[model samples]
Target: MRKIQLGTTDTMITDYCLGTMTWGNQTPEADAHRQMDMALAAGINIVDTAEMYPVNPVRAETVGNTETILGNWNRANPARRGDYILATKITGKNAAFVRMGEDITAASFTAALDASLARLGTEYIDIYQMHWPNRGSYHFRQNWGYDPSAQVKSVTLAHMEEILDAADRMIKAGKMRYFALSNDTVWGVAQWMRLSEERGLPRVISLQNEYSLLCRLYDTDFAELAVNEQLTLLAYSPLAAGLLTGKYQNGAIPEGSRMAGNGDLGGRKSPRVFDAVAAYLDLAQKHGIDPVHMALAFTVQRPFPVSTIFGATTSAQLTRILDGLDVTLSGDILDEIDAIHRAHPLPY
Candidate 1:
């Protein structure tokens, strides 16, 4: 229930953000509403969604359904809209269904935001993010063969300039309060920061990258950048897609689980991931703390500003995660976690 500053912006967001990627697909609208009510009651103010949500099977037909559900709730309870900090993203290239697979340009950015506003039934989005870079990212299982060389330097800079211009225009138009990045690399964040400074456009307020106990990609360069650049880390998949929760241990995927919907969990499933999860689970049990609490708490305890984005298909799951908010780990427990990390550095 604690609130943290969102970058240099005047907005203060809850330490835990409610993620809505599963709202319309793995979770129904009624369940989404119930979860929203529960999350609001718990003092969770940030609710993050994307233009292309209801993910798991991310279909063209189901695109924007999650925002629609949120929009419905906003319309029904107009007074409640001001109670939450809402964020959404504009899809990047490679999604064939969005903008017919065109890379995000100034025009495409405007189009995406207009449509997103319509879907969310909001006059202005609190935080508008670039879902991913047009040059692609190292996240989402692409780190194995990911290469940034495919994009020309001039092209990338031009894209950044154009996007920043669009973001500035949106800010002036009252369509968005601030802009952020998602699934970005350290260099990408630097480019955004540099471009914003040069053009006097909206600065990059946050970077929503994947970070969890099993996935520590942000611990290296990104951590330093986050601190120095004053960019808050809106860490998505903070539970490593539920791996850190220890529910998928020993090849046990419960029915209707995310793994069941997408067999590989968007590239999270690997031979060594289980070992990493087991180590964290063992550390939690040794300290007599729930693994979910340890995992969520670990993220907020990082050196930089972090708001862990967590989602659940059921209210019970939400309650369990919310209960872990106040559970802080001790120094000895952190030392043990570090020892485990030393033994198995990069399990996935």
Candidate 2:
């Protein structure tokens, strides 16, 4: 694992980031701690979690358990906090369990930041991000019915200012170092950049979005914004929720898997998705590469600066992925991948 410069910040972070969305649900606390240990040993320097995590169910009961599990690790590894970067998100609207589904205001922002700090048992966070735009997003398989016609520009601008002020306060108070966005659009990102530049608040450094060979939504406009603005892309679900791993292929849903519980795979499962997966799987087999490695390496080796935020529920999965971090895809493979994309783009 190699490190990269984090945006315009002086800090350097690993090209890989550990995701803990299933830490407290399918994975036990001991296993979660062990995964954290394994991540550090493997040279992965960043761990990302959220206030509403461990979420196969996404119920009220386990909303904050993932953060608590991570906090438990911190309590035991008291001296190793500085070894890895920490990032977490504030849940946006529709999660009634979190602040009764309220939008993010300056007051709500401060409250959520304070709560996240308490749950992680950390004084400060390296990156604090909005899980999604309060207005809504085309992410999470919602692109088919996506509509932004109802969003009021004046309201959104004021909201951005308020949130930026909230971020400014948190940074000044030593609660967080950077602010970021997740599941946002190009316009949303542009506003943050403009507001930060005009108001001189904390600069937004990164954007965490779903970017995989299976999902190339960010390749055009978002890629342009990231390159010109010096914003790093934190790619989530680079494996397409384990689709690219080929485990879920041939209509076989492994027990205790995400698809087993939520058969839809967050609405990503369809006839076309399976067809796309087969194409990529065939490509991997032809190249004599593991699909997981090929999937991850493709994202990390993108033309844009990106760090893949991948997660595993068990030790075997974790180690297998760690072992393949060095597998670099050649020019032929990339060209083949692009050809495959052209054949079956956004199948889901």
Candidate 3:
């Protein structure tokens, strides 16, 4: 695994980050620990999770179980905590189970970080992120009816200032290292940056948005913002939540899969999604490459991507994803992927 500088920070994280979204849900605690061990042994230094993780079902009862699982691992292996860079998110809106559907205000941010650190059994988290904007986002199958006009500018600026003040306090208290954003747009990121610069608060080191071969929204405006602002993209859903793995091809939802856990797979279950997946899978086969490898390699090959976060419910899936760390796509394969994108863009 190749390591890259994480934004302007001193930390160097692996290009492929181990994602723990399935830690306490589709994957068992033991399996999560085993996967962590394997990822560390394989030289992956970044582990990404969320306070509302283990989220295939995303029930109130199982909320924060993923961090708890990682906490247990950290407690049992205290010396290993410093070996890997850990990143987790505070839930945004839509998660009624978290903070009773409160937006990420100063109090909510402080409360969330305190609880997260306690659950992880850590003194300081490496990277803390806002799960999404307080306003809505177009990600997660919400692009059709998404509207940001309802948000008040003054209210949003006050909210940003509050969060940045809270982040400064957390940094002083040694509870978190840095703040980042997820599922954010270009304007949202600019506000975060501006707030940090104006208030002398912790600047956002990364932005974790949905990016994949099927979704190239980041290649446009966000790519430019990332490059100029020195904001690295910690790309989530690099495989489109396993849609690009070719396992769900032809409407075949294997038992015990993510799609089986959540039929919609977080709103990625469109009829056109299958066609897009088939095109990428065919492109990989045409080049004599594993689809999983090709899909992940393409993500890592993006210009402004810092780390590609990938998760697995089983170790076999993890191994397959890890094998693609060195698989670089050829110019011919890139052209084929471009051709497919041109034909069927934005399938989901």
- Each model's lDDT: 0.90, 0.92, 0.89
Q: Mind giving the per-residue lDDT tens digits that candidate 1 earns over 1-348? A: 788899988899998999999999988999899898989998999999999998989999999999999998888888899999999999998999887989999999999999999999889999999999989988887888888777798889988999999999999999999999999989889988998998888899998998887789899899899888889999998888888888799889999998988888888888988887888888888888989899999889888999999999888899899898888888888888889888887677
Better of 1 and 2 by lDDT: 2
Judged by TM-score, which candidate is best? 2
lDDT of 2 by residue, 252-313 (tens): 89999999988888988888998899999999999999999999999999877798999998
TM-score of 1: 0.98
lDDT of 3 by residue, 128-162 (tens): 99998888788887888888889899998888888
TM-score of each: 0.98, 0.99, 0.98
| Cα RMSD of predicted structure 1 | 1.0
Off by over 4 Å in 3: none
| Prediction 3 TM-score vs. true | 0.98
Preferred candidate (lDDT higher): 1 or 3: 1
Predict model 3's lDDT versus the native.
0.89
The residue pairs found clashing in candidate 1 are: none
Ranking by lDDT: 2, 1, 3
Query: Which scores greater on TM-score, model 1 or model 2?
Result: 2
Model 1 scores a C-alpha lDDT of: 0.90
